[model samples]
Target chain A: MSTPTETDAFEVDDSSIERMRFYGRLFLGACIVATLVGIVALIALVFDVVVEAWGWLTWEFLTHPPSYLAEHYDPSNYGDLPTGPGGIYPAIVGSIYLIAMTAVFTLVLGVGAAIYLEEYARDTKLTSFIEANIANLAGVPSIVYGLLGLALFVRAMGAGSSLLAGALTLTLLILPIVIVQTQEALRAVPDSMRQASYGTGATKWQTIRNVVLPEAIPGIMTGIILSLSRAIGETAPIIMVGAATSMFAPPNLTDPTGSFAAMPMQIFEWAKAPEDDFQHIAAAGIIVLLTVLLLMNAVAIYIRNKYDR
Target chain B: MTANGPQTVTTSESDGATSDDAMTDDAPLGSPRVDDAVIESRDLDVYYGDDQALHGINMDIPERKVTALIGPSGCGKSTFLRSINRMNDLIDIARVEGDLYFHGKNVYDEDVDPVALRRKIGMVFQKPNPFPKSIFDNVAYGLRVQGKDDGDVEEKVRTALERAALLDEVEDQLDSSGLDLSGGQQQRLCIARAIAPDPEVILMDEPASALDPVATSKIEDLVEELAEEYTVVIVTHNMQQAARISDKTAVFLTGGHLVEFDDTNKIFENPESDRVEDYITGKFG
Candidate 1:
């Protein structure tokens, strides 16, 4: 195709544009390859876990509390011999309670902080410093958060070996994710929408409540789902907060101050018990955890698509 | 004719003696032959940070009349229009120095409430910005914002739509999203929204610039009809639009000077300023 004479005034030579197109395609290919690599690893891991654990997953296995099969508690010999398997009911209940409590605290705290930062805070030096610290805090290791929970919630708060401490630990570990995503959600709302509201004589809070909040809700919800998934999967923080691997005497689900066992801790204990049946139960537990993560991600994607319209 | 039996300007020779009025200049522009001037500015200056936008603007906008401000790009025409209703207050760096008197009250006074003031003086922006709501809701926004839930909301919305010439087109689909309407229809919906609150002064900032030729003509006619009720001030780059619809025209030239303010016929037919004549004649590069 030939270019029009009139277009010559505005259009640049095609060579540079062609070069940019080539680079764009190259970059797109590279990104797809990276994504496929991650996907392949995930698929292989899930397949292996499913094949190994499918037979062990049963109503009975899920309903009964796990117990040791060996005659004695020999740490060295346990790994070499076969151990009988029980259920993961207590661990599942404990995780659900922990995650539920974490969501309640983290959602309220994160969304409120995000709103203040995005809407009310002025672009001053102190605000920038606080923002920089929050970004840095998000990158800190989950283990550090575990230590913090142990120091603050477990010991100082006098909630020894309790679900409350584990919940608080998970909440802290995921709070930064929630805040960052919520802030981005609020920021994605165009300034024009706010201006239109103001032009109609609406006050600052009125505009935010009426226009900005409605538009930002879906994004904030997506953030919550993603953060909660991560919280549910955390093990170190729960362990540091005094979550027990073997809750010999299981506590009630609502017992915030009693000892708890999460899926990770239960699975970790079972897989190390030398019994083939315990290893099968561990694989089954992994499959259940992965399914929960997948479901949460799906829900997040659904919310994002609904809001994008 | 002005409402109070005298326009902001006076008869050529006799009333020129009145030197107390700050806006009254020595060079006679013309007698504002109308009844009353609803809004008047005296030595009004506008600034965006350190940059001076408009300088020494003095004019009386006659009540229920169309006064158009025309200028080249960056010549402060839009700035002047925004200043009338204190819309410039939205900009952080924008500052107004001189007095803008509306119905003998200075809006810039410390005691004046800007939100209340905005309700009385509505505005329509250049691009149509209808809310992402239903057509009925968009028209009802102005009233709803004020918590006016009187049973007559339906009647008020209908009347506003009728006045804006959008009722016939959108009456059947009041529940449909405002964004679903055509460009021209959305703009008319905006007009209905602005007029729903029953403001006395309505400012249009190139309200028809984004539409097609047919839509532009329709808006021009709507503007002329609007001037019969509310005081209308419009800023436009289209010279013919200013000439066709306006009662009085203020010619803002380069260097932020309003070179001429006179009857539209006089300005278009026989302008007094050399620069205004050059601009009207398309002599500028």
Candidate 2:
């Protein structure tokens, strides 16, 4: 190919410029439409759920456990509950317990693994292999993790379809995501900071603990919160790990090896029921789940903003 | 030379010669030294991976004086400076060969920890890199890292900032973030941080290259003042800077060879090598 002459290169083609501008606008329009598709669908779904749950989302509905007989339900008979169609208080409590446990387990394991990989691991084939495997694991189906948890925690450890088993399953499901995000957070800290610490005669661990970790904490916190939000919404893994669809009482917070129920599991059961009232109850349950997720995201944003510098 | 002229040392006395003596014997001759040398390198070679960055560098830096390493880009001046404190150890590909002595002890010996070596030799970089913490914390970082952060931390930090010529500007705002300062203030903050640990020597890699003219002059003044209390080795691209502030100047050429090492006046006005003269007169790098 020959290079363009100076004169030819300097000359601007108006038609071609117009055509390029038109194509750029077309691409922008396409991107806007693509974005609006997801946003509109989400808004429509949320609107439908709010409308259906408007009458059912009451203090009684929130504070009482689910009951079988809605017409005969009475506040005075609260001692003997689950006989009348009441609320999803037990499910909410169970979900919170599962998420909290999952958060602790995943945070410890994920941050530790990330620190090892990013800070200590040498650049070799073995480390690259481990890194690649972790990335791949993040993309694996949640049900596969559920099976692993079922085999390891539920059967081998004899946790017996309890809150421990469910939380462990969710932990496994989101561990890879947490690890990957934590690695990103750690890597985002500038190498200059590490050099500064080391130049001051700080040992390797001292540098990491003082300079690296402090700078990375905000990013790590955001990653943990986002991963916890994802884990809280996971239904299939919890189901596979044997979360109860309905419960009269919340799981014992101090006892890990006890029966549990989760919001998604309760919603699934309610949505599956033939009664229309149960469907409205499921919608209300969805609203509660969404609110938890929104709160988690808000916390993540707040942390990122507060400590961003 | 005047009575208080730059301390000049001659390296051509070939007595007790080793194989490395051949390289240093060819180096330019200069006046006799008055001050005791604090750091010495014998036929030091540095490599980044398989590429040699410094070739047979041999010199002794005098105590309590500013020694400037000046060269064009890619001449390994920075590499030599980093080698003194083993800051190059941070790079996995970097390798060092030959003896680098501090107080008659070879720093590259097996038992000498790089961390311990660095405690006595602090560094400042080209860019002003103050930590994302308060100004007091930034200056106190080095002391805290060395576990010297006891009751007198406030007094030591103030002295450090004062020596760095930054205390007057930031006395009331010690709790403000170091990153909030201007470029010159930040560089001084870094200098204060380095001095807070009370290191015997400070290595600076083009510390004023990124600053404006006013900031650069301020840094130049600080460097001269620092030499009163600590030995300082600096790398610079500006020949004028090497002349204006340095007591001794070592000029490395394009091939990572130390072409001339002498008193700054001699190196600038009457270099022994034609290439050095050419470089000084701006005919060629």
Candidate 3:
């Protein structure tokens, strides 16, 4: 009524609009920088490792063992034949052995505990306390597991610094992960499904075995794959439990119980050496480790995509 | 909607005539009990925690008969149906009192197992909940849980699907996921799953409520056919559906009290209780 003025119709403030744009740009810019940092770091690591190990990624380097004599060592020399110094055959075999043992032991212990906790154990004060303690154990340092393995399995248990000791330590280290993952998998199954099974005259154990486990298998497998990848890359525990890098070749399926050298321990030993050749071999070892981890993660991703729906 | 006195019908005890033949053509099939009774519940009461859902309810459910329970929202018709199979025991807070007899056996006995009870008495829910498996596997689930692994599972699954009136549509897509089916098809698949184990009694809690008119008619026909073998008890909100399908009708009021139960036609045209009459007439629910 005072006066139909144009400024009265337009009360928008330009400064506030500019402030909003400023925050939006700040957020977007921060995200872009963080993403670039991750990509650049990954590319740099890949380039450095690939360049260093280019000289050592030959068939000879893969098929022979580390030589004891310097005259015949020939670290950089690939002789006439396809064979050469320092084949990772022992380390590969040993890593597989360690991983298998870790898987079996961890699955048995972890899934068993999970089943008891989720399906059977009463959710009382004691059970809650135990659950909290297990979650806390997951955050404990990996090196602390190594020290524990040395104290318990090696000295007290008289297992020595053998593959068994290393396997046991790695198993304990990943047991918490498996337990947590298994619980999550079990929990993901709908309560109605369980009721349906029970309503069909199936007993409690029968319901868990037939219905619940089948539904949770994919999730459990994904957890197992991820855990195995971490266990394969674990060095501190194995080193603490005395996995020697000097071992030529340790064991196979037929002799699965025998002691062996693992890839991480071998890489650690080679990386500590001052020679440039040893560094190249260490880089190659790292590449192999990365390959295994990549394969495991790929399998996990494939399984998760296939069945998590 | 004032309360009217009970209209006492002076029909003879021997008069077994149904009030309307249009809806009562599909009579259930079971061993003809010279004394016609399948389930007998006496002074039944259902409680959830401290709250009582159903008061004392006494009724005789005839074998191989379609008995429809109708009520307004929050009525205890579903609760009454669940009590027959002891399905209420599944709820942690639920408590049941008095006696429910199935084939003359006390379902609430100390030694009685709810799982065993449910095996004889299967149930279908309002919403379709087919397992996230192939159509064949979904039907075979009930049998599989019973350890029927003779490889004749396929034949039984087909038979059940056929009985549920879904075989013609899904026969070609046996391997397809059950969830891929339309809502009505999925509901029929659930019905097939329920009947696959050859349960003696099938309890449907608003089985057709989620379906459209066409799908509802299909289910109604399917239920009629199923009555030839399995004793059927259906809970529905649609009074017309109850009149169209059920031989016997039970009307429950607020607080889970059974107000009237009689022939479906009688309950609709000339209900014994004023409350039931008012409910059916749309004066009150």
Which structure among the candidates has the greatest DockQ? 2
- Candidate 1 at residue A51, lDDT? 90
Please, what are the lDDT tens digits per residue for candidate 2 over residues B90-178? 88889998788899899999999999999999999888888999999999999998999989999999999999999999999999999
lDDT of 3 at A289: 84
Q: Compared with the true structure, what per-residue lDDT tens digits does model 3 show for residues A187-245?
A: 98887677666656667787898778988889888998898999899888888888878
Interface DockQ per candidate:
0.35, 0.66, 0.34
lDDT for B17 (candidate 3): 30
Q: Whole-model lDDT, candidate 1?
A: 0.80
TM-score of chain A of each: 0.83, 0.90, 0.89
Candidate 2 Cα outliers beyond 4 Å, as residue runs: A1-24, A70-85, B1-35
Q: Chain B, model 1, TM-score against the native?
A: 0.90
Which should have the higher lDDT, number 1 or number 3?
A: 1
Q: True-contact fraction for model 2?
A: 0.63
TM-score ranking of the models: 2, 3, 1
How much does candidate 2 score in TM-score? 0.91
User: DockQ for model 1?
Assistant: 0.35
Q: How many backbone clashes does candidate 3 have?
A: 2
